[model samples]
Each structure stands twice: as structure tokens, then as C-alpha cells.
Target chain A: MKISARNQLPGTVRATTMGAVMAEVTVDVDAGAIVAAITRGSAESLELKVGDKVTVLIKATEVMIAK
Target chain B: MKISARNQLPGTVRATTMGAVMAEVTVDVDAGAIVAAITRGSAESLELKVGDKVTVLIKATEVMIAK
Candidate 1:
């Protein structure tokens, strides 16, 4: 499996309550760009640290680069 | 709790083998933009039909929008 993102965004990650099967990774995008967040086991296992810089890649056909 | 994509991407979703915990949603982004794709059970359970328009939202700290 491959994971890639555009650039690096700064955030502080906090461990949240466990999900149905795995724990949740809550990252507070300091700029409030991403006010709230929740990710499953994979991201958590990646050891998302607090005050870490990670990339979030969103891939969809509908993402339009409009000028 | 929420699933959102930038816009609607065109793709033909074919059910692949079941994942470790849930089934995988394999959508062939016909345009070849996404080229290869794999999503977890949630996308499949959403009733992603073949040749449907779905939005894929990827939230991470590293998305950089360069102007």
C-alpha cells in the first residue's frame, strides 16, 4: 500500500477513544484549516506524533484546479 | 461521522476481494487520473454503483496548495 500527500501540513495529533476495531488518531490542524479530524488504525499505527508534519492526500475526480 | 469529496469523480466501481476486516471498494477512475484505487468497506457499503460519481475526501496535515 502506498500513501502520498501534496505537501506538509503542521498539526498536533492526539490519541482518541478506540474505534470499533482500532484506536483513532485525532489531529488538530493548528491553523484551523482542518478543525476536527479522525482516522482509523492505519494512520494511528503510523505513530502520528503530536506537533508532527504529515501530508493528507485526497484523490477524487471532482477535485478541480480552478483558476 | 462524515464523508466528503472535493467534487464528483467518474469511475466504475468493481467489488474486489474482501479486506482484512471489510470488503474493498475498487473504483476504476476511467479517466486514468486515479489510475489505480482502493478504498475501505465504508465506500462499498455506501452502495457505490458501477459507473457512478463519487467524491473521495482525503484529509491529512500535508496538503499544500501552491498558487
Candidate 2:
């Protein structure tokens, strides 16, 4: 599917934690692992599993830069 | 609306740049500015404008921590 987010980091699913309504999914990228919290429904819809290839979409109006 | 993402950072819209299909929206947070690339439709639907309050939703299975 096409998304508006500009940053799409390809990574592998490292782990998943299920909650009553939300689930935490982790993606291992070259730089580091990105953590995402999504609803259980979305998780099931995505069929996210360990070793699954996924893209991390980040759309923030502001990205804090540190010097 | 209820979203699955765990990280929701509250900030103000600093700037917005429109593109053919996507738009770049900048948010100014306490720590820093987060840049988000979103679809024109979503942007307009959200009625995102300068000085608007927004919450950045981030959902990933893993979060990398650096030293």
C-alpha cells in the first residue's frame, strides 16, 4: 500500500508483545531497532510475525535535532 | 481517534510544505522538531495548519537505545 510518510526503513521483525488492545512490534534496522505500538487488530491484519519483513513509517511534523 | 502507536508526542505545527500528493509538516516539540511526511489527503483531513496541535504517533516493534 502507498503511504505518505517519506521515511520507510526496511527491517525485520524481532519480537512482538500482545496486550488487551495494543501490541508492541519491534523492527531491527541497520542503525537500530525501532519500536512501534499498534492496536491488536492492526497487528493481526498486518500478520506481523518474527522474521517478517516490514517497513517503519515515521511521520512527525518536527524531528528534534541535537547538537 | 484511537491509534495503536505507543509514542505520541504532542507538539505544534511549525511549518507545512505542500507537494503533488504528499506534504511535509514540521512540529516543534519541547525537545526538538519532528518532521513528518504525510499524504495530502490526510493532511487536509486533519486540518493541519501552522500552530495547530498534533500528536506524533510512532509504532514499531523495537526501539534502539544508544549510549
Instruction: Give model 1's DockQ, 2 decimals.
Output: 0.05
Best candidate according to TM-score: 2
Tell how far residue A64 is off in model 1, in angstroms.
7.6
Q: Number of the top candidate by lDDT?
A: 2
The local distance difference test score of each candidate is 0.47, 0.76
True contacts kept of 1: 0.00
Error of 2 at B38 (Å): 4.3
Model 1 TM-score on a 0 to 1 scale: 0.32
Model 2: runs farther than 4 Å from truth?
B1-67
Task: Tell me the fnat of candidate 2.
Answer: 0.15
**TM-score (all chains, Cα) for each model:** 0.32, 0.51
lDDT of 1: 0.47
